[model samples]
Target: MRFALNHIAAPNLSLPDFFTAAGELGVTAVEIRNDLPDVLSAWDPAQVKAEAEEAGVTIVSINALYPFNVWGGDLPARAEAMADYAAACGAKALVMCPLNDGTKVSFDSLVGALAAMKTILDTRGLTGLVEPLGFPISSLRTKAEAIRAIKAAGGEGTYRLMHDTFHHHLAGETEFFPDWTWLVHISGVTDPDVAVDAMLDAHRVLVDDADRLENVAQIRALLDAGYDGPFSFEPFASKVHDAADPKGALKTSMAFVSAQL
Candidate 1:
């Protein structure tokens, strides 16, 4: 299992401490974020690159540029800024998320957005990991839809899918796109009372015996289908963020998931 950690796993930690935690967990790959802890605002790209080098950890990605499927407004500018920051920080990719406000964005708009973003990504030698948010209100909710848009935009080499297990369940998608996927975000929802559609980021937590998201099964399926990539932890619950020992909790969860496989 190639395990990676997102800074959301411990939003309280500073970038230096986050990299140390990843090393302690025996993981060489990690994903940083522009939200939550917001490492981008706290440190310069040179500092990020230097710290990552000192820690001997790879900055797999910057967590995201949101509402990226809407090609206009400040999105074009934001995308370039993010891509520039990602390149400067030595991050390998930039995660791109679509509009999740329950509004309809046309297919033409989606493809157009990808085509525009591809240029920004291509110029910086970065891969855009297009992640579909599976919220019922989300404009894009499945890997299949993302792939179709990517292909329509002629973004075959410049883009890849972010196969998020939580979103996969929420979207009710039965098909897997292992070949098109380059990264996987894993988290669990342990609240048994909440209906599937009602689950949100607040409900996400570390994977455990009580997890209802079928993370283990999802991981097995992806791996068996030849998706050789890192499964990065991305829990967004307040409880996880407030944990006194986030690394310890993550280690336990990692052990549980590994044992299951």
Candidate 2:
């Protein structure tokens, strides 16, 4: 039950402050993001590396390279740039998300994209954490599909799955790939009125007794199946973002999840 924090959990906090908060919670691993707080746009890679060291926290990953299944049109350049930044900042991995606009990308394209990105990640000694989006419109909506693409691309050594609890529920995934997973993103959706098909990032909130996403079950299953990794908090709700004491809220949620488990 290793816990970690995602920058999205407290986008308002400065990078150093976020690190400090995680430290207060006895968490030393964290995921930073290029969006939300957009640390990449605001801080130099060397600065980010130095700050993480100063805070005594490890930068587990950079949130992602989006629509990664689309291989052309500057995607390669962007992928290289992100991998370089990740290496420079001492992050271990880069999260890769597929296209989610209902535009279907061929299976060959998915494999080709992964193969191309593998070279970049390998050269930098970084892992590509492929996360399949679960929205109805997502081009790659299942970890099984992602696994096939990774195997086809011969990227098993350079890529791993990012099992996001929210996406897992939305994708209606019944199987767990613990051996292939290196990270897990956990959030809860508690809106009683919102249908499962209608759930969005705005509905994501900290886990509690009212959580409807079965986060505990998902985690227990993963652990039982031999997954030993971090469970990062990634609530995207505005209510969470605007919290007056984000760290306190996160701490409370952390306790609740731990108690339930």
Candidate 3:
């Protein structure tokens, strides 16, 4: 299985340092967060592309565009610009997230957004990886919903669902979509005492035996069910940033996950 590291996993590191560390850890790809310290958004497209190529790292996908379904006016232009940036950075896809404030965007609106985004993606030769957030406030809560929206938008080959373990658990979804899933974000919630309702992005971290969430088991099931995609680390735990050696922490986490595979 190919391994990719998310920039959120080591938020303290610079882009060059993150790439170097990922390379040292034998990771094949790295995902960048637009909201993070070092990102493609901060650099010129050419420079970003050159830096990634020189570091020998591939850009898996841009972290996300929030409330993508409610986008209007300049949103399409912004998405197009981001897609162009991704192309310049040698990225494979753009991760689009749904509204998470319980605004109740209709399924038809979601389909419309996907169709609009797919048009932009097709024009830029990029793929749209739609990710559904499972938080109570989130409008979209399952990969199944995302899959249906993609199909409804007539984006069969242009778009795919991002299967996130944390959200899958939060959304109470038990089924897997091996054929339509393009990427998988693997992270676990370690605190059992922390109520599931209160869990947020901050609870994310590398999968471990102590995790209250069945992350490893879920991943195994996905693999067994024919998911042939990269399992990227997307830990949002603050400890990852506070650790003395983030690369060492990543190595330890990778070892743990690899054993399960």
Candidate 4:
């Protein structure tokens, strides 16, 4: 299993410390975030590149440019800027997520957005990782829909799906598209009081017996279908971020997931 760490795994860590922590956990690949404080704001791409190189960590992808399917306002500018940073930092890809506000975005619009982003990505030699959000309000909700949009936009090679376990469950999707998947975001939702439809990102935590999102089953299916790319930890719960020993807790969860496989 190729396990990677997202900056959300330890939101409090400095960039250098996050790289060091991922290295210490025996993982060479990591995902950085712009949402996390001082993670991307304080450093230029050159500094990030140098620090990550010194830490022996590879920045797999930037964990995302949001509302990527909605091409309005400053979205185009933001997309280009993120791609520039990713290319400069030696990151292989940029995770692109859709609108989560419940308002519907038409299929044609989705395809158009993808097609437009494809040009930017190709120019920068970066892959656009299209990740469908699964909230009730989310415009895009399934890997199938993302695949359709990608193919429709002629983005088969330029774009790939981010098969997120938590979102996969929330989307109530059963089919798997392993070949089109570029990255897998894994997190377990263990809140018993929350209904499946009511599960929020805040409910996402580490993998364990209490997990309600079926992380193990989803991962098994992906691996069994020959998807050998990295599965990055992406817990969004504040409890995980505030853990006293984030690395130790993460290692235990990683071990549990590994043993299941």
Clashing pairs in 1: none
Residues 65-108, candidate 3: write the lDDT tens digits: 77789869777877888888888878889999998887899999
What lDDT does candidate 3 reach at residue 2?
A: 68
TM-score of each: 0.99, 0.99, 0.96, 0.98
Per-residue error (Å), model 1, residue 252 = 0.2
Q: What is the RMSD of candidate 3?
A: 1.2
Misplaced by over 4 Å in model 3 are none
Residue-level lDDT tens digits of model 2 in 165-220: 99999999999999999999999999999998889999999999999999999999
Clashes of 2: 0
User: Looking at candidate 4, what is the lDDT of residue 155?
Assistant: 94
Alpha carbon deviation, residue 99, candidate 3 (Å) = 0.5
Whole-model lDDT, candidate 4? 0.91
What ordering of candidates by lDDT runs from best to worst?
A: 2, 1, 4, 3
Kindly indicate the candidate among 2 and 4 with the higher lDDT. Answer: 2
- Against the reference, the lDDT scores of all candidates come to 0.94, 0.95, 0.85, 0.91
The whole-model C-alpha lDDT of candidate 3 against the native structure comes to 0.85
